[model samples]
Target: MRKIKLKSISIAIVLIALMLGSCSDEILVEEPRGVFTPDFFTTELGVQGGLTYLYQSTRSIYGFAYFLNLGETGTDEYAAAQSADNNFHDLDLAGQGNLSSTSGFSIGRVWGTSFPAINTASGIIENAEAVNLDNSLIAEAKFFRAFYYFLLVQTYGGVPLDLGGGELKFNNSVVRTSVRNTVPEVYTKAIFPDLEDAVNDLPDNPRLTGTVTKNVARLFLAKAYLTYGWWLENPNSIPTYPEASRTDPDGNSPSYYFQGAYDVAMDGINNPGPYRLLDCFYDVHVATNDRHEEMLFYSDRTEESQIYNEADLGWSGTDGGGPNTAVWMVTPNYTTITVDGVSAVQREAAQSYGRPWTRMAPTINVFTETFAEKDLDSRYDATFVSSYRGNWDKGGDTTPTITAANGMEIAPGDAVISFLDDYDPSVNYVNGGNLGGGEIAGRSDYVINLNEINRRFYPGLWKLGTYRTDNAGGLGSPNGALTRPFPIAKFSELYLVAAEAAVKGASGSMSARDLVNVIRARAGKWCYDNGENEPRVEDNSAAMVAATPAVVDIDFILAERSREYFGEGYRWYDLVRTQKWTEYASSYEIGGNSASDHSPTVTNRTIQPYHYLRPIPRSQIDDMDMSQAEKDAYQNPGYQ
Candidate 1:
């Protein structure tokens, strides 16, 4: 595990510019008393500052911001959590039509933001070498630059491979790279080389300071290779109207970039890197505790990565506030599942699917399908809560009265237990039991029931703000307040990714069942042997069941992904890669309503092939100097 305390690179840059006047008096070669230009910060400190700037951008990687926004919307992740106000609306109403033809909203923002980041990284890399900064720091900057460019290639096709450093000032008239480079070309040309150098130069440990470590480099390298390969080899995952497939309507078959996607991705995975999946059981809780892990390449913190808070539930807070329910419905609840028939309580239970303006609750269909899997392997219980409700095991106040933060005694009136009985009865909201019918404070249209309760997570509401601690001196919850329980990252995913890479790369015959068994072993559970076609479940007590490896397949891995990482924010991507988008859409619905089906994050619902890769931003299209046919082909259908 590595930890790097990053500097505020942007702030440092501004300070340097202010001190260094642009207009230089040629009289004296060495400028005035306190002036410093690109040459001044080009020192070790300056390079370090620059590296930090690249990471600062990572803070924007959540549901509403950037990372998941593009990935979640218009994809299975988007479709999985579609709601009226979340990402689905943007995709449905704004991004409805063709990929090459439409200018969608977020699509444009991503394009604009990505390049600035690329240039920032490029600036650091260029400046570091000019001043001869420490080799390690230079490697860190290079890794960051490569990371951004990789994203650009993946998202916008052949983005201008700007190695221009700080020399090029910001300008809107920037041209798209002469032609889109193939994914393979971009990887070989940029990503692989940088990472190879990075692994050599970066430190072995986190050092509790902000700097790219060997682990981070290794993780990114692995991810880049895994994804590029997966995207390329699979025909369905590849964009249908690939940048290569389109022509000037003159019938010219443009070059495709899939090979690059494959090779570099393969390199990252098989390279003699020290990175490997940290054993999930031992490492999962530890990773969350210190934000330390060999697999996590980046994490975001806006002055603070708040601990889990239990009070907040609905979505009505600051921007980048909590997990957007719209894109997080697929995450499993940690509290309700059992070990050998005894509930394996979630001691560190925080919000998995976050608060919501648009509640992206799992559909009865998703729940049903999940249940069906549980029927096959009771181990799937580790994926979802066995019951949506739990007992209110309050230490002091056993009577059911919840205290407010302001020391106000609030008694929930006539609250109906809003959960299915078999789950848990003590804590659920019941009709007219307390809090006056549990009527959503303002809206009375929807009643208090299992759906709404489950939408909010039945047992307890968690947030980044609330963290529970048994002792006053403890690291588990620095604040000791109840915050959202969002597992921004998890260990189970590493196993799954490894499984995908192994299967696709043909690196090894690591069966999906073997990988799954490893994950279950960590979670203190195991898949049962039902011995039937309909996927039957055999009860295995803490004492009895023997571990037997089953045949691993894509479908099994997918089910595992859905169960384990649902709301942690990668379900939709898994669905798309596995071509389960339409199948999932046909089954799930809006805010837990089965019949009122809608797009996952976007509004209108339709799964078109062109949508696999989002439409290039509408604004970008208008700015492009392409031919009419090219422009027509790229126009945004959903843009208003």
Candidate 2:
């Protein structure tokens, strides 16, 4: 995998504008400046460019690869394939016994990208009055600044605070070494204040999907408050800083922010804004429906907004990463075999599901119970691809010839999986009976169960696959390039957030189960009443959890989130904030599927108290030049 480099960025030169007189009226026109300078911010274009860069900086944060590594993998919902190379490969287990520390490379990317963005946003905020544009632009800048800071502070508790643009010189001087702020101070001084003002300043509706809106700021603000509230209750956190809840300015109990989080989430839910859950859940991820009501904000990947060029195959000049989708979520590397006289060569993921490096796999927690129910939950079938076209050729030709040796012509939507070889190693001696009795004994039903998919042929999450696009011209089609938009905040999550806040003592117009029941009922709303609603004759128990019961709680909500937001990159944060890492989480064998010889079953994943926060990058610790005492004081609490 390619790594993104983190290098310090200096605010570059002033844009020089040339004045020219118009021929007709002798009107004076102010030309735009090429270089960026402190004075240029006084002009409209400079402020716009600065704000644009602030959003662009985040492209790396939501990149398919980055989010998988940072946010999703090694959690209860998902795990990486067993590539057997480095400590990073298996996130669920520790390299030896301890969870892995932040790689300097990844941490550098975090510090290097986010801090500079903060500096730029600060530069914009400080110069807001000087600029002639609307305060909204400056307000947008504040949101981004708070946004970057919040991400950093959550990962590495109380990072060094540098808000303004320009140089901050550091020497070996003891007093000169910047002292880190308390966790509360970082929020109150930096994250809270900025987002508070931003919510007031930004408009209710943003001009673009990627741009921040008032509702957007409030959503994050609620999340920040919730995080702060939860941290107060954590016993393993807060190394030396004074307990925040004891001296909180709010004068409320420790969970004050929980209420605050709940309140803001309600405001968002009740707000008569454009954001709402789409009726058809499948429409949420398709390219054409990118403008749906579910989108609160998304990382822009269209040609118009692509800042990092994926088209630059050479990866020259700029730190290149193309506009991307979350295709890396559930694709497995599978070769082809002829079954039932139908020959389907395994297609390139880029063509079908988009190139999957087999980065991560959906665990049994998701498959069996979380996303169970073939007849009730339409999401199960809508999200996974059980069939692929066997073009019988890959010579760059528009059409490939298929013969009887290639078997019957399988439609694009035909069954891709057909065997239920569970290969439990313990139970399997050679006999078969796991299938649905008629569809091939123990054969995986691509629609209801994943029995057809063996170790190598893991059922690919059809959500990320652009398989819908393959219909027009087939595998070698000209359209549906792998690079697509990745959803960051969906209105659906806001509903879940509202449900959680209500459970945690926020205002709840509806019960937690009622709120979650909306999602559960919606999952089954699209499916037709078929015999598969319940388990089949031979099928012992596949849809046990798939039954839509009205029972609900925090555990129920979290499970539903696993089902709904699986691989959308929210698992790790969910586990951390709730402190439920050990409750029901499971370990698994990765790399290949259950049948693969290469796959190894890994167990005893350690989710410890120290892991509540990630260590600051070693590079930053070295750069700070702190003594043993100072280092202990400055670094995150539990790291070496």
Candidate 3:
């Protein structure tokens, strides 16, 4: 995939404006020397520069591993892996660590990085028209402003609309006192209006490959309306920050918003411009096909240029905030799989096998339940790396051949370890053995039954795994940041969104089941089998559509979303919006964190009502010029 290198520009104004909360008692103020003022955006170059910076800032949140943890670790789709640190454990909501105001899960990335980007967007929006900038260019600014605010509202209930100046104004000066608007105010005043305008103004086709367009705007607008409807419903009685009534400022009912969400999403689906679902699920995520038409928006990365990628292409060690390393968290240490006392499956920077942090693992239900129809639904195969093939020669191991399970000699490129599609009672499990797998009769591969998968040894997320073209037949840059674009939105999700709205009592020509069947039918077609590591052609769309329940509900739609978008960082928000987090993920089963531990243990999480929203970053509170009581009140309900 060719990398689109956006024009680089200095965003000194945004950086300095974000220091508003950092003022001290005895402030030593100085005249700005090298800073660009908001007036700069009135010029043509400055407007273009501001727009470029807005796109650049997305790397801080979307593909960063820590930010992924905030979105997935505590939810049903993932759990803290055996080797996880406090950063992962704190978000787990288990006993490993407390998710306090001081937690280091990088929730503040959404808070800190977003405000500056919002300010930058505001500068462009306020000044672009003065320079005769095209309406489309100004619409980009509006889209970004609404985008950041949507993220802010979802993460922390109601963030400050007024950064330092008035609401949504460009602030060139630093001020310390900040007050958060209510949730209703944020949606009605900022997110809704800006997105609506953007949907109207953005072109049907993108000016640049990855730039926002009218359909992108419509998707976000539909999502915002759907999410706001849920907030108004508040069926779970989850409390909001700043304690406001769960009513729309415009006095619209929840049904009104739900119907609106359905209408907008269907409009996008019907009039899809330059966006459509790929032929199959595998095509959507395969590294070779990164940034395909199905992806509506994504954070771009490239192996072609280190500068454009924003991180070293050769090696990036555990750095967060800008690299596409979130996939590493879900990757297992496949290099540990040995045959005849020789490491068989060597770690390489291939999409099937990459550097493994083992910081997050899939829940057991991911195998037994969510993907129950592994044969009919090709998504299971498309999503995970279930087979570990021998690549000892790639690591300079000249053993030529090694004795594997069943006393069989296996060569390079053969299956060294395979997570079986079905459990076999006849397989002899190696309990307390050095090898963490069982030997199936007549099979040369070390096999792990569906029941034997654990935290330390499970399928790696292949969909977002590393892909590098510079391996040169060796373990190339296994520890480096992934060069594939981390997907943020896809065209397939439009069907899910419209279906979800229909379930929420929206009137639509397509019923809830009809919309869901659209997704399920696509899922049943297979072009490549990830486990077999070969091509396979099959079409079971008929069976897939036939199996759909006549009446689909919210739970069914949530399950479908999980199957489609698992491990891409969509779980927590989906659950939170539907108020199903605690009900669906409060308890899960996984084996102990040891090679010999094969017994599944049920672990429980203390998901509180206040956990619906994360705590405000402690640093943000400390920097504020408010009294102790005021600071406490500014925080979300539970954290203080």
Residues 37-76 of candidate 1 have per-residue lDDT tens digits of 3553456555544455455444334433333444544443
Question: Taking the candidates one at a time, how many backbone clashes does each contain?
Answer: 83, 24, 0
lDDT of 3 by residue, 265-311 (tens): 99999989999988899999899888788999888777776665767
| Model 3 backbone overlap count | 0
Ranking by lDDT: 3, 2, 1
Give the lDDT of residue 582 in candidate 2: 60
lDDT of 3 at 9: 16
Task: Return whichever of 1 and 3 wins on lDDT.
Answer: 3
Task: Report the C-alpha displacement of residue 197, candidate 2, in angstroms.
Answer: 2.0
Residue 461 miss distance in model 2 (angstroms): 3.3
Best by lDDT: 3
lDDT for each candidate structure: 0.40, 0.54, 0.83
Which of the predicted structures, 1 or 2, would earn the higher TM-score when compared with the native?
Answer: 2
Q: Write the per-residue lDDT of candidate 2 for residues 1-640, one digit (tens) a residue.
A: 1111122333432222232221312311223233455564566666667776665566566753455555665676666553322323534554432343355223455666676677667667766677665777778888988888898777766655532212221111122244555677778778988899888898877655457788888889988888777676663453334224434555555468878887777777788376776655556654556656777776654433122333322111213333344454356553344434334444542334444445456655455566655555666655655444344344233233322212333333333433222323222212111111123333332211243223344556655554322343444422233445566777776667767766776665766655666666566544221122232222212243345355556787787777777666678788777777666564643334443332334544666565656666655555554477875665566566
